[model samples]
Target chain A: MGVKRFIAVLPQCQALGMRVESADHEHVLFSLPFAECHIGNSRKQLIHGGVIATLLDTACGSVAVCALPRFEMCPTLDLRIDHLRPAVAGKALYCRASIVQVTPRIVFTEGVVYQEKGRPVSRAVANFMRLGAGKTPVEMDEALFSPNNEGEE
Target chain B: MTYSDSMAQLVSETQRSGHWETLLEQIPYAGFIGLTAQTLGDEILFCMEPLESNTGNPLLPALHGGVIAGFMETAATLNLMVSLNVDQVPKVIDFTIDYLRSGKMKPTYATCILSRQGQRIANVQVNAWQKDRETPIATARVNFLMHDK
Candidate 1:
């Protein structure tokens, strides 16, 4: 449940082409690049709605981990996504998730995905149930991300 | 136009052409996850074959949570695509998914209902199940911006 450890265990994210763009103590950003392999409908050249849903789920889950008082894998209780627009093909989409609330048993978070700056394409909210036994809270910064300097990568 | 009229027209077109099956086959992610489409009279059925590649929790042997979400979302989109008989993919306006249960290592089935349509937007609901039609593992609501033909 240490904030950063949760992001490290996501093999599914790698399979779907999502990478972390930024992360701090309370907020995390994820980016999903467009690829032919991930396109939902080829004729229309749209990124699959399912891919966006995956991104929203992971981003929201990351927020839950960040909000956790200790390191425990929070199970997703529920998730909701609203597609604001069709994700245009050939552009990488971005998402940023933040913790909305944290109760002892559950965590609430919201996230938004977009291609262009300031224009959101989709948004989602999720709830994660905290586990009873948690690992000791550790320094999550070093283990959280791949080596990419904030402005450089 | 009445809902019945449009529904009848879609059934006729898809029955003759198998448009939904073809579209599901063409999508890359759909193919990646082994998604298949079957038309049952007025309903479109989406199926996912169990595979090691699609597994997220090896310990539980459950399908990845994302895969289930993706499958249901694709089912909802394809439902609208075939029903409206539209040329372009309907742009999703929003989607809400409720994961009622974990999808285990077995074939999963889904169906979608085109709940409402306005001039520019449409709403769809999807139900996914593993064992019984009466019980669903997940439910989703997807809103789309219908394209101008």
Candidate 2:
């Protein structure tokens, strides 16, 4: 499956309404619109720190997917995130992630999250273990990328 | 009452009554992801019931990596709030997580250890597991800035 389709088919991404803004082998950018369910502090309406982590993880993981020669299931090994500031309420969040390094065994990625162009709210660095296409489950491959699958849009 | 004052009151009531569920209700995101807390003595065990929407790899039927991180972060935040008995929500300064294994589609559980609590900052370490506590699926360290009232 393509990077965009892989992300689109992810149930968690669908539930969070994550949108792919742009993606390529070098980097991938994603955006998440504001939702009441994403608020951690109801009184202040601040976006949950966990929500920021989720966005970063998704962006970083997607970029890792792009870096691979063929789509492989790379599970995250470790992740580090720095919350520069609390995300503003009711504003869509954007994250841009790119590969920092890739080895035979692991892929390292770094990403930044922001609501606006320049003002970053958080940063993240993560590494994923490279499980080759051989590890890809047959059912998942067919369910995600099957050309004959219904609703090919 | 002011928001902070009410929050402080709520925290105190929660601690006194040993009812963390009421506190979890205040966090909309926690509820959205199906997070619940159970108190065991002075410790709290956080659980995320298996939900189809939280799945990332349907073949493995595993929980999303992001969902696992979110659950651990939330667990750390609540643990800090209750441990310090603070009035305001703790702000995450930084978080580091290590995934030891894939989080399967099961009721995942997490426990937080308050590593250190300074006046303005607190450090928490969280371990999440499914099926067996001896083997953790993921572990995380979270640093939080305790906002002043």
Candidate 3:
């Protein structure tokens, strides 16, 4: 519901110039524009692997915020990122993250990144330690988490 | 410029600057991140200078998780490049990071251990701490594929 809440909350995310394409109770999408600083190898013209991970982490965190019943402290407990292929340069990449499971103390989510009409460039699964938001159980919205709910923006 | 061009430029800077910190500026992304490096005896230290552009949460005043990961990964890569005595960039194959604590708004430091080194791949374990080394803010293990110059 609060689409603007993310840009308003995390300035670093804003600084990364990540765009929130869509955010609703159903799904969350984030896109990061290519920048000179994002290039890992000026020769291969590849996007830095860490930058991809950062974008994916932010995307997952964004969904966690958009989907959580209330704003809470959710810090990454663990993050595993796999690069299927080098992220080609000169194209924006997108990530769609859905909360797979949420418990009183933890949140699990996974996402994939790719360019327009391109095969997945990378994939990631992350776990966040839920914090601060009191122990109220979060209601599970089945449709919001369905794997079919994914795509651009 | 190609990787070899950048590699040559970095090689000369190390020869002329007589300081490994020059690597921070030679790499475009490293310069953007504002990372600083120092050598104290046998230990190599990497620090992320606090700049407003790198803050993740202005509320907790914490360093962005991505920045922390980037910094740690950068540290590992650079250290591997130096330890292996290679001139080519190490491409990251995968990275696994654990956030032990919120990285507060301050200078954060990291040190890397080149755990396993081979002709084609290397593994580095990194520990990043904000205030106290005993209490690290985050830890990461990275595997990189080494390329020949």
Candidate 4:
């Protein structure tokens, strides 16, 4: 999507400092660099858990549309995350994803988030339901996936 | 991706990087990597290594969900170094994650990629794994707001 077009689609995502690291029809990759503001402590950094949840949701939703035409919308049905560790602030992070399985009714995907030097950080699997053409999928926003509380679908 | 020293050096430059370190000290999780700040060509990297005592989640054997989310957020912020072109922390607008499997009883690493960068918004994806990349424990997608420094 063009810069203007992307902005129109996700206006609230602006605070993430995201940059399209790379993309293809079947795959897309994104990045977020760390700095002082993201840190929680000298011994550790404070990164909101919901941020990770959103990354997985978007990756899965996009992967669900891999077989569909561009500009199509796919909404998430189920998203589960297993956080492994506390992220260290002031570092670069890399997130990559692809469509693992897709069906007429649903799309199954697996995605990963990593640190520079190719260290594995977290892995996620999700399912997305394909929406009818010209139909808007369910509105699943960040507030719905905050780690502070056990999210409800 | 290279560390400035073999062992992380606690210095003022580290604190000046951001308040992440400051906040991390308040939490009592053992899986925190405790990384300071990093720099790249238009990008910066975040680092964290799990502590040995972080076994609070008996079910997962490693870090807890709350802690993992925290790490994912940190990785997303690293992408800000590219979008904002500054060393400031990016505010998370919203995000989602899918936990593929429970992490190993060891450390989990994470990194983020910026899929869309704009004048007012950003989109990022994060992947995390332990020991081997072949098997990932969790993945996430995040959106953040870019405002004045």
Name model 3 segments beyond 4 Å from true: A135-153, B1-18
Candidates in order, TM-scores: namely 0.81, 0.95, 0.86, 0.44
Instruction: Give all candidates' CA lDDT scores.
Output: 0.75, 0.87, 0.76, 0.53
What is the full ranking by DockQ, best candidate first?
A: 2, 3, 1, 4
What's the true lDDT of residue A49 in model 1?
78
Considering only N, C-alpha and C atoms within 3 Å, which residue pairs clash in candidate 2? none
Kindly list the per-residue Cα lDDT of model 2 for residues B29-89, writing each as its tens digit.
8988899987788898899988898888776778898899999999999888887789998
Stretches of candidate 2 off by over 4 Å are: A138-153
Fnat of each candidate: 0.64, 0.85, 0.64, 0.15
Where is model 4 more than 4 Å wrong at Cα?
Answer: A1-4, A35-43, A137-153, B1-149
DockQ for every model comes to 0.42, 0.84, 0.65, 0.08
Question: Which candidate number maximizes lDDT?
Answer: 2
Per-residue lDDT of model 1, residues A86-139, tens digit only: 787899989899889888888889888899989998888888787654332333
What interface RMSD does each of the candidate structures achieve?
Answer: 3.4, 0.8, 1.6, 12.3
Better of 2 and 3 by TM-score: 2
Ranking, lDDT, top scorer first: 2, 3, 1, 4
- Residue B114, candidate 2: Cα error in Å is 0.9
Residue A90 lDDT in candidate 1: 96
